[model samples]
Structure formats: C-alpha cells, structure tokens
Target: MKILACYSIKGGVGKTATAVNLAYWAARSNYRTLLLDLDSQGASSFYFRIKAPAKKNLGKRFLQAYGQLASQIKESDFPHLDVIPAHLSFRNFDILLEDLGKRKNRLRQALKGLKKEYDLIILDCPPTISRLAENIFNAADIVLVPVIPTTLSERTFEQLLQFFKQQDLSRSKLVPFFTMADARKQLHRETAIAMRKRYKNFLQHAIPQSTDVEKMGKYRTPIDLFARNTQANRAYYALWRELEPQLKKA
Candidate 1:
C-alpha cells in the first residue's frame, strides 16, 4: 500500500484540507483509500463527520488494545474510504510511544496489519516534530508539506528539509507546495518565486486560498464533493493529477 502523510511543522496551513481532498480523489479513482486522523484535535475526523468516541484516559488503554482500536477504525462510517478517528485520548500518544521504547517506529508498527487493506493511506499529522511525527516520516512513502506563501512558512519548509537531511532520507520524497496563496500580496509572489527557484523539482501544484476550501468544514465534505466548480476544487484536482503516477507506482 502507498502511505502518504500530509504534514507541516506549523499549523493553519491547510494540511488537513490537503489530506481530505487527496483521500477523496484517491477513493474516487477507485482506489481503496484510508485517511488516518493522527491529530489529537480531530479536525480531519470532524471534517468527515465522524464523531470520535467520548472518553477520558483512554490513550493508555488504546495502546494496550491496539487491535481493538484498529477494528473500530475499520468499522467507522466512511463510505469508500476508512477513517481512523482521533480523540482527546490521542493527546497522550507521544508519551505512550516514548514510554514503550519504540519511539521512532510506533506508528509504523501500528499500521503493519493495514497494508493489505488499503491502496492508499493518508495520515493527517499534527504540527510538531515529536516522536510520533518521526514515526510518520519513517513510515510514509511521501511527505506532502504544505506551506503558506510567507517568510515564516518558508522557514518552516527549510526546517523540514533540515530534519529530513538529519534523518538521511532522500530529498526526492519531500514534496513541498504552496497553500492559501494570495497573488495580490507581494510577499506571496516573492516567496513562491524563491521556493520555485530553490526547490523546483520538489515543488508540487499550489493551492490558492479560497473561501470554498474553508467552507468544507461547515459542509463536512471534501472540496471535490462539495464544490467541484470552485477554484479550490480545481486546484486540488490538479494536485491529485500530479500525485497520481507516484501513488500508482507505490
């Protein structure tokens, strides 16, 4: 199975939106897609209208009962795509993973049994460089880094590259893209130009900032399903097209 993680060191850069749209495109293309919500806030789960179970102090129990957690994920109410909903229980995941002394491979181990069931797996990661994040990096075939066209966002992209370099990973797997772009702003234009110049081959299609993308939250649907005619939807379709060959080969 092809595993892709949509991630960013900094939040509010449309990582969840990218994951949701990409998962929808993969499923629409007749691939068995699964989107795992790894963020404790559960935004991806909420966007897909999957309500996480209400319980406290369940994180430790979940790690101890990994099989049951996997089963619950498989039985969740997502149509063509399966969802592994995240809850408040996930907040302590980093601690549990570290305590187990399998910090770097915890997520990879948890996902071992799911390889045969999905053609594509998209992980919605939280914005941090923790052990869980390292596990995601180690497990994914590709890490899709979404950055807004700003100096701070560009710095975050550089930090991500530095992290990858430290891990001794191939830079080819680091696909960076601009999200929430506004052409009217000079900084956005300048930043895009700089990024294209520095990481030409690593750059993917840009996703423009649009109200339609934000509306997906209220609609609880992917942009492809909610507003196909909108600019955001078309942008995501372009991004999906760029990703198609890589996914198929994986």
Candidate 2:
C-alpha cells in the first residue's frame, strides 16, 4: 500500500484537515483507505467521530504488534474508510520509540502486513521533530507537508528540509502544498509565488482559508460531507486529483 503522511513542523497549519479530507476523497474514489491518527490531541479521530483507542490497547508494546494494531482499526461512517484512532498516550511516543533503540523503520515494519488490506494509508502526524517523527519519515512513501503562506511557516519548512538533508533522508519524498491561503493578503500571495518558484515540487492547488473548513469541528465530518460546494472542499478534491498520479508513480 502507498503511505502518505500529512505532517508539518509547525502546528495549526491544517495538517489534520488535509489528512481527513484526503482520506475521504481516497475512499470515495474506491481506494481502501486507512487514516491513522498519530497526534495525541486526536483531532482527526474527533473529525471522524471515532473515540480514541483505550490506553491499555495502544501503549508502546501494543503499538507495533500486528494483532493489537489490527484489532484497533475502526470503520468510519464512509464506506471503504477506516481509522486507527490516537490515544493520549501517543504524546509519549518519542520516549517510547527512543527506548526501542535505533530502529527508525519500526513503524514501517509494523505496517508491512497491512499492505494486503489497504490501498492507501494516510498518517495524521503531530507537529514535531522527534524519534516518532524519524519513524514516520522512514515509514511514509510521500510526506505531505502543509505549509502556511507566511514567513515563519516558510522558515519551519526550511528547517524540516535541513533536517532531512542532515539525516541523509530522501528530500524527494516531501511534497508541500499551501494551506490557509488568503489571496487578498499581499504577503500570502507573494510567499506563495516565491515558495512555488523555489520548491518545484509544491502542489499546484492551494487550500483557501474558509469558515467551512473551520466548521469541521462542529460538523464532525469532512468538508465534502457538509460543504462540498465550497472552495475549501473543491480545493482538497483538486489537490487529491493532483496527488493521485504522483502516488501511482511512487
């Protein structure tokens, strides 16, 4: 199965929204998609109306075990979509992974058997660079980074790139896209143009800032379910269309 990680070094960049919406579209397109929420806050899980897995079932020992992991998979309201909800204990992932020694590929190895059941696995990751982040980098086929159109966001993206370079990781695996874009703001517009020009791999579609996206928390569903006609929803659809071929190539 192809794995896509929705991640960012900075929080509040629309990472979880990207993951939830993309997984919905993937399932709509007849792909068996699994949305794995790794963020301790459980935003993605909440969006899907799925409860966090109980603490006992999701601790370090059970996390990488195939049987325990498989048992935790919960079906979403949409067909062909399932989720492995995050637990509060996930906040301790860095320490847990550190205790496992230098096994950067542990997450990948744990997910190997899931390939037979899923066509796509979308990981909603926490905003940090830790041992768990290293595991995600090793596991993901393409790291989908949501970058806000601002100076600080761009700087953080650069930091992520520098980390990849220093760690000898494949920089080509990162595919960045603009999120919370406001065309009216000159800074946002200019940053978008400059970053696109600088990073040749940036996705062409940019998700706009909209109240409809913000309402996902109240609606407890993807934008398509409640605001399919809205720009934010259409933007995600376009982004998914742009990403599907790249995923095939990967």
Task: List TM-score per model, in order.
Answer: 0.92, 0.98
Q: Per-residue lDDT for 1-250 in model 2, tens only?
A: 9999999989999999999999999999999999999998999999999998655627485456887778889999999999999888888888888777879998998888799999999999999998889899999999999999999999999999999999999999999999999999999999999999999999999999989989999999999989879999999999999999999998
For model 2, name the residue pairs that clash. Answer: none
Question: Which ranges in model 1 have alpha carbons more than 4 Å from their true place?
Answer: 55-58, 61-66, 74-79
Query: In candidate 2, how many Å is residue 249 off?
Result: 0.7
Residue 31 in candidate 2, Cα distance off native in Å: 0.7
**lDDT of all the models against the reference?**
0.83, 0.93
Per-residue lDDT of 244 in model 2: 98
Error of 1 at 146 (Å): 0.3
Find the candidate with the highest lDDT and give its number: 2
Candidate 1: tens digits of C-alpha lDDT, residues 1-250: 8889999999899999999898888887877888889888999898888878776666666655557556657433445788888878777778888887875766766676677787888999999998777888988888888989899998888988898899887777778888999999999999899888988755567899899989998899888776988889989988988988976664
